[model samples]
Target: MRMTEAELAQYKRDGYIVFRGLFSPSEIAILRNETARLSAIEADTVIRERTGGVRSIFRVHEADGATRSAAFGALVRTPRVLEPTRQALGTGEVYVYHTKINTKPAIEGTVWMWHQDYGSWQRDGCPRPDMGTFALMLTDSSEMNGALYVVPGSHKRGRVEPYYDESTSYKFWAVPKRDVIEVLKQSPAPVPIVGPAGTCVLFHCNLLHASGHNLSAEDRWHIYISFNACANAPKFTEKSRPDWVVSRNTKPLPIGPDVLNSGTEAELVRATSPN
Candidate 1:
């Protein structure tokens, strides 16, 4: 579950690293099914894009009865996930800031502007940029399917000014287009993180990245597990977004294994829904 020396070096240099098939096929299948079921449900957490496709389903890991599901909980807490997260952040302990399914819907998903995740975190009053995201692909991500495009080593640039745009199809505070162009001129060639369903991309919070539209006939579903050092938790009490979006819980995750198989199939099915 821990990263090798070479892998750590690459991550330090590139600002990200992809672990292919880090999760087994059986585990991936369960996640895919669970995501589909959550997306179909009528919930306040499920957001719709301007194109009328599902935008994201937030905080499934912290959702009511859903949190009782062993599989969903383990996806974030298991050593395979948690340990590397702690290592990358160089923190002794960490907590799930939030976890959600970000969907690039088949045929109509829109572009995510070039941005650093830490920009938003900074606005949330997190004093440090010592956080990162682990994205688990739930479906094959190809260049044509809106795979993530990252500027290698861009994390070293630190936080950049976000172009505040709320009029777009997907509202986000992004790095301005002009800044992106300049960064591209100096940075290494942008990398398209293409991989299979079980692939996981562990990326630095300050990494500048974006994804284009999905013209292909397949959805790009990625589960983002964002973690923050327990010592570096946000300081603001006044929040702009829902608690689910910005987790209120600062409790460190407990280590466990095989949480998915710990319960019967019937139990998992019943626990997926909050109601």
Candidate 2:
């Protein structure tokens, strides 16, 4: 489950790396089902597009009781995910800052403007950029289906000052067009992250990335789990977003059994619950 030296180097040089077919088809099926169940819920955490299509569901890793997904709970603790995350962050321990599923439905999916994730994380009061995100594709992603596009090695540029924009269909801080242009000038063309279901893309916090609208007839869904070094947890504030968006729990996660391979719902819950 550990990252090879070559993979680590590629991540360092490019700010991200993609592992195709990292999870089994059965595991992806479970995640797809969990996504469907969560999407139907009536909650603030389930953000929808202007057209009423489910956009993103936040804090999925912490879901409890009827809403909980044992599969996702186990995913956070999976060695294939955690070990590489720990190696990439160069930290002994890490915690889930938050987990979210961003869905782009057929032709109704909207665009996510170019931005660095740390732009929002910094505003959330996280002082350091020692964070990474593991995005697991629940459905096949392709150019026609709104695959993510990332600028190679953009993390080396550090955090670019982002402006808050509410005009977009989804409101959030976005990198200015000028800044993105400048970054693109030095780097190779932005790479579209296209892969089949069960693919995982691990990227640095400051990596500049965005996704286009889904013009195809197929849906694209991906669950992203943002991990923060335990030593680099954020400072909470009255102005900060809800805990569902910015997790308050800073406890390091314990590695658990591979539920994708074998583990009952009760065992998965007990293994991931806080001590």
Q: What is the C-alpha lDDT of each candidate?
A: 0.82, 0.88
| Model 2: how far residue 66 lies from native, Å | 8.0
Of candidate 1, the 10-residue stretch with the lowest lDDT total is 62-71
TM-score of each: 0.92, 0.96
- Model 2 weakest lDDT span, ten residues long: 62-71
Task: Give the Cα error of residue 263 in candidate 2, in Å.
Answer: 6.7
**Residue 225 in candidate 1 has what lDDT?**
92
- Candidate 2 TM-score, true structure as reference: 0.96
Candidate 1 structure quality by residue, lDDT tens digits, 1-275:
89998998998899999999888777888887788888776666777788788878777775363323345765777788888888899986898888878788988787888899998888887889999999999899999989989999999999998878785565768888898999999999999999988899999999999988888998899999999998888875755566777888887776655545445565554444334
Best by lDDT: 2
RMSD of each: 3.1, 1.5
lDDT of 2 by residue, 118-140 (tens): 99998888889999999999999
For model 2, what is the error of residue 190's alpha carbon versus the real structure, in angstroms, after optimal superposition?
Answer: 0.4
